[model samples]
Target: MSTEVKLSQSTAIRLEQARTKGMSDADILKAIQANDVAAFDAVSEEDYRYDEFLSYAADHGENLEVAVQDGYRITFNTRGGLGIYLEKAFGVVAEKDFAVGEGIITGLKLKPEQAEVLAERLASNWVITESKDVPEGKVLTLKLRALV
Candidate 1:
C-alpha cells in the first residue's frame, strides 16, 4: 500500500520552479517534506507562514508577544490602553489598537530606568510585569495585565 501527499498550488509551482533550476526530484521532495508542512501526522489545508513571521522578527531583532484575557470586556478594559501608553511614553503611535480584553503588549525598546516609570503609569487599572535577560540581556518581554 502507498500514500500520496497532495501539494497546494503554490507548493506545486515552487516545486516546478526548483526543477527548472536543475534540482533533483529527491532533493526537491526532501525540501518539501522539510518545510511545506509541520511534523504532525495531520493534513493542513493552507500554510500559516509561521516561518516567515518568525524569520522577519529575527531579522529585525524584535521579541514580541500578545495575550488576551479570557472573557475580557471592552467596557471594562477599554480598547486603547496600550495605544495610549505607547504614544505617551515612547512617543510612538500604535499602528492599531488592541482588541478588547487583549490588552497586553510585550515588545518595547525600553531602557532599564524607563521600565519602572512605564509600569507606574500603566498601573491605573492595568497590571505591569517585566521579564529580563531571557537567554541573554539582549531581549525583553513585557507582560501587561488589565483588570476587566
Candidate 2:
C-alpha cells in the first residue's frame, strides 16, 4: 500500500522552482525531510530573524542569557537586560513622564554591582527610570506580550 500526500499551492510552486533550479525530486524530498522545511516555513519572519540573531550572538561569544516567546517578548537575564533597560528608560524620560518602556529588567535577584552596571548601561542609552531591587530568591515572573 502507498499513501499520497498533496502539496499546497505554495509548496507546489516552491517545488517547481526548485526543479527549475536543477534540484531533483529525491534531493528536494531529502532536504525537506532532513531540515523539516515545513516547520521552518511555519515560523514567523520576525521569530526566524531573532533566532538567527541569537545564533550570531552565540557565535560571537555574547551568548545572551534570555528566554524568547517566538514572535512575542524576549526576557533577558539581569546581565543581558541592559540594552532593553536603556531603550525603555530613554523613551520614558524623553516623554517627560514615568512610563515604563516595552521591555523591563527583572530577575531572581541581581547583585548590587550587577544592578549598578545595568543602570549605567541604561543611562548611557539616555535618561531612564531608576533600577529596582528584587528580593533574594524571588521567582521571576514572565509576562509575554505580542510583538509590535
Candidate 3:
C-alpha cells in the first residue's frame, strides 16, 4: 500500500529551501515522516505572533471585563513575586525570574517588551495598565486590555 500526504504552502517552501541547502529529497521526506520538522524553522522568528488567547477569550467570553473596540480587558494580580506572578499568569516561570529577588512585586505594569515575552507563552494582543501603584509591601494589580 502507498500513502500520500499534502504539504502546506509554507512547508513546500521550506522543502525547497532545504533542497537548495543541499538536503536530499529522501532526507527531507524522512524528516517529515518522522515528525522532526518544524515549519517555523524556515521563517523569521521576529515575524511570528501568538494570538491563541485572543481566540479563546473571543470564543468562550471567559475574561470579558470590558469590551474595547477591537478586544476585551482582563486583569491579573501579583503578590508573592515575579516568579509566582509569571507562573500564575502564564503558567510558566522563567530562569531570569528566579535570579531576581523573590520579594513581592506590586503594581508592575507589563511593558511592551514584557508583553512580547508573555505573548510567547499566552499569545494575545494586549495592553497593560497599572490601575494603582503598589504601596510598600503590597500586592501589584495590573489591568490587561486586549487590542485588535
Top lDDT: which candidate number?
A: 1
Deviation from native of the Cα of residue 108 in model 1, angstroms: 2.0
Residue pairs with backbone overlap in model 3: 106-140, 107-140
TM-score of 2: 0.23
Give candidates' CA RMSD values in order.
Answer: 19.2, 18.1, 16.3
Predicted candidate 3 versus true structure: per-residue lDDT over 84-146, tens digit per residue: 435444333444322222222234444444444443322122232223333322222323233
Q: Which segments of model 3 are wrong by more than 4 Å?
A: 1-6, 38-148
What residue pairs clash in candidate 1, if any at all? none
* Model 1 clash number: 0
Q: Can you write out model 2's per-residue Cα lDDT over 30-86, one digit (the tens) per residue?
A: 544454444333232441222233334345433122111011111222322433232
Question: In lDDT terms, how accurate is model 2?
Answer: 0.32
lDDT by residue for model 1 (1-148), tens? 0222222222222333343445555653454345433421122224322334323333543221110111111112233544443444344445432122355554554555555544433434455454465332212333434332
Candidate 2 vs candidate 3, lDDT winner? 3
Scored by TM-score, the top model is 1
lDDT value, candidate 1, whole model: 0.36
TM-score of every model versus the real structure:
0.32, 0.23, 0.22
Model 1, residue 96: distance off in Å is: 10
